[model samples]
Target: MWPEGIGTGAGSLPGADPREAAALVTGETPEFPALPELPHRSVGADMIGRTAGLLVDLAVEVVPTGWRVTPRTGRDLRRARDLMSADLDAFDDACDRTRPGWVKIAVAGPWTLAASVELASGHRVLTDHGAVREFAASLAEGLREHVAEVAERTGARVVVQLDEPGLPAVIAGSLPTASGYGTVRAVRAPDAQDTLRELIAGIDAPVVVHCCADVPPIRLLAGAGAAAVGIDATRPAFTGATARVEALDAIGETWDSGVPLLLGLLPGTAPRREPAIADLARTGYDLADRLGFDRRRLARLAVPTPACGLAGATPDWARRALALSRELGKAFADPDEVPAGGAGPA
Candidate 1:
């Protein structure tokens, strides 16, 4: 779904100003800009809260622990909705003069949302199969409408990015229970795949499944019919001397299957040392080398991204990181053109 010389941010930016955030992302990655997510605004603007705003009939309220399912819509859900509405307004205005051909919008995947929100009884929604299924259905229907509205407003093909940062924990049963006394039961790979598949099938546009875990389920995402898989290449599972053989093998297999990877290569926050364009891109090159693919294949098979969200970054670094990611995209397309010096000070 990505174009040449293009890169994208991983949803969240550091600032609270939606107008500025939208302008910055679009100005930096004009070809395929993402709808900048400003989590710093408030709890409603965070990943879970933002996605919760897209529920059709269901509503959520913030509890002492986190978001919880509610019988009736409350102030928390209203605030979330208002924040989302404002973002859409800001994004629409930002693109008023010249709209991008494609815009990526990120939402929490079913598994992540289920794992995050608590039920009325205080257990995770994922703990009850029926409740989770209902939420997924609501999300699917809501997303269809949301996508249509964005498409109409921006006049661009909308690409849905399902951010599943919680998927690994769900698969491994590592999430603490509401009581924090025991772990939830592990979800079977097949079951998880099936739910994801159904959700993807429901969406009108192509879906990119993003999981920035130490070892995201590349095979499972591919099996679930993801058009692209987003991964953190800087993680030990995918890079460095300690990289896992299995992780490399899975990544190689996914590439061999012709599913492009959204490779997270740039630092999300300010690095201790400034890095050259070539330096920041080394892991992607090494990954291709280890996979036995031609170095040039990276240009077509990978889309560069920051290591994760920029919520923790300084505003300057966040902008610079997106700019660098775009430069890396060009470098991947033509390795000979890397600039001479390091990317300037943090």
Candidate 2:
């Protein structure tokens, strides 16, 4: 749905000011501004904690071993809901002031949430297929309500992004057990795809699956009917011959299927130094060229994003990063703004 090169954050800004974060996003990305995620506020405000509020008839409590399922609603779950309500209020205020067109909201995908949360037995919910299914159903219903509320409050179209940072680990069987002495069994690709597919189908709005890992199962996600697959443009290099070859193939397949790629071209964390806009834009241009697509096609098929979340960044850098990300969007929209060679002028 991006007309010009639209800018968006990966998720998670640096501070607790949802209003300020929302204001920055609305100011920079006029076309598509996302609800800013602020994990630095700690406890229930983190991605996992905030999304826990969406589960139907489910409750979670923070433990020494992270978040564990509870038999009934507890303070932890209440805290999560309270923080989420505050964020929404802030977002509503910001939207009323800025009047954005379309706003994006992020939640942990089924796979990621299941991987992060623990059952009453102290094992990950992903370890139990039945639990996973129930969690997915709950999440689907919760997100529907959340999205409808957001749209009604802001008077803007709502788009949902499912952050699946743990999907790669789930597929690879890399996550440790609650004891940390063993790894959980890896999920097969087909099963993973099926779970995600069903989950995406339940969401009422457009869904973008975000996974910042080096190998994010791009083809599987795109095939699962994700409108967009978000990945880190820098961490996942396209220069190598092994994984890069497979990644390139996946990118081509996803694009060929009419799916947009949310490219993380800008730094999310503080960079060693200020980055040149052309340098970042060139990453997308080069990627397009590698796939034998014209640079101009990137405007239609890509959404510029930060390399990852900005939770670890300085407040100043976070704002600067968002601004830079917007500049990259403009460059993608018009290559002449910053030539593909990555240098502005002779």
Candidate 3:
């Protein structure tokens, strides 16, 4: 794992400065740099413009269906790609002129992309193994170039986060079983693993796989050579007395493979203050102790992020949350100065 601080979503930048938003997302102080304020904009546009401006070096913006290409919609997917690419380039420039760090460019993983993208026949590409493989290769190539471009602009490492929210569902065959969806086809575990391995290998920087759902293919992700595995920390998979053992098993598996875990501790939508900070640290330490991992290694592996992105939050809340994440990160890194048992910063 990269052993960095918290990361928030590109919070809504509508009429808000991009630099400030970028700072918020990357845990930089508010006074770092201001960005262009884009008000009342679409989420996709807002994410692209604001994230690029935040000097994140790398980020991903999910375009809603209106922007996505579908046979039924007859929308030009190329146009969407062009717009996203341009925004990334602009963001890359902003990073060069301002903050310098690894730039992260993200995209939906191939399986998720196939699950969502519809062909002219109204069939989901995910059902077709051949088609899915092709899509995965295409995405890998595209991201490879995108990473290269971001690197050229920022002269920093380019990490690619593969967002695969549907991975668990697919693995469980839930996607195929859902009504209105075609026959449930299982993805061979090895094939799925190989696809991700190839994608990660093609990238120039360390790779992280993020899955917010329960019982994600953590072992598979590690085998694929991912440097870190990000999962919801507040809502871990284990419950009851079995929770501790299960948690340890999970953490041990990842750590044994030398893959650090990014513990999602922050409640992205909640108020941020001392209480929140205390809660986050306690949770981090508790998990570490249960997992039998070194507190220091846990500190380095534990990136206190929101359970997910904060696009749903208010601007003020998002800002405060970002600040709290940074503060808690400092405390986690140096527990002696910031006691985990304390009631947080007053």
Candidate 4:
């Protein structure tokens, strides 16, 4: 379902020009490319805004509280759709000259989307069972059409990366109500997994679920039928010397089960100087060693990505970070590329 290189975890350069961002994505990550998400542009291009564009017959408008469902279309909703459309146009043109082999597109997953958007009554959509099912169905339908359109224009196999950054909060019931007096009920693991399964069903594209949270449900995501689970590998859960047994167990189990892990190894910020590719790639190498997988297995099972979105990075840093990541991908392919002694040779 993926190739061996670094791909953007969906969001790109710090500007409003979707074309420049999209074009940079195409130019930088040749191993695999993704549709650049330009959330820095404004409200509409953010994760929630982009996913809102895909809601069928449902409209979400920005309010003082956040995204709220509306009975009729509104300016906020229109802006979201317009920015999304412009992104598509920019992406189409970016890929026009030389069609890509594969392109990953990101949208908020069912649980995250439900948790983020509010209903007409000012409560989260996830609070209502019927609304949850409805929104998932609408998202599934809308995604199918969106993927088809992207495939038509870019001539690349479209891979969907469902960003579930809010899933942990949803499962923990940490999200406060609009009034901030109480919290929403925590969703059971089974219910959350099943809901996600329904959202991805029949979508007809390989799917990757990205959760950069401290406690992303690795096994649950696999059970939900995600082809790959993107995680923040730099987090203590995965990297600390005494990283919790649960994290180790999950990593071992997921890989042993033949599921790929989209490892987030790059920092999404500007370092004083550009780091060496091997220096940047050491985490993946060490991870493979820790998990007892052969060095070569890293290339086969791991897809490198930024620790999170690059929206906060300067434009120069964004491009450089991606370029360095592509090199990390190459290093994954050639074990000797990292040198035997230490993080790449001096």
Off by over 4 Å in 4: 5-12, 340-346
Which digits, one per residue and each the tens of the lDDT, describe model 1 over residues 231-311?
Answer: 998898887798999999989999999998889988888987767787777777889989999878888889999978999
RMSD of each: 1.8, 2.2, 5.7, 2.0
lDDT of 3 by residue, 253-279 (tens): 887777777566656565544355665
Query: In candidate 2, what are the lDDT values of residues 29-129, reduced to their tens digit?
Result: 76787888888887899999999988888999999978999999999899889888888888888888878788899999999999999999999999999
Cα lDDT of model 4 by residue, 143-260, tens digit: 9999999999888999999999999999998999877999999999999999888777768998888899986789999888888888988888887485777887788899999888
Model 2: residues with Cα > 4 Å off, grouped in runs: 239-243, 339-346
TM-score of each: 0.96, 0.95, 0.79, 0.95
Best by lDDT: 1
Off by over 4 Å in 3: 1-20, 26-79, 176-183, 236-244, 272-274, 340-346
Q: Rate the local accuracy (lDDT) of all candidates.
A: 0.89, 0.86, 0.58, 0.83
Error of 1 at 58 (Å): 0.8
Clashing pairs for predicted structure model 2, backbone only: none
Model 1 has a clash total of: 0
Tell me the TM-score of model 4: 0.95
Range of the 10 consecutive residues with the lowest summed lDDT in candidate 3:
50-59
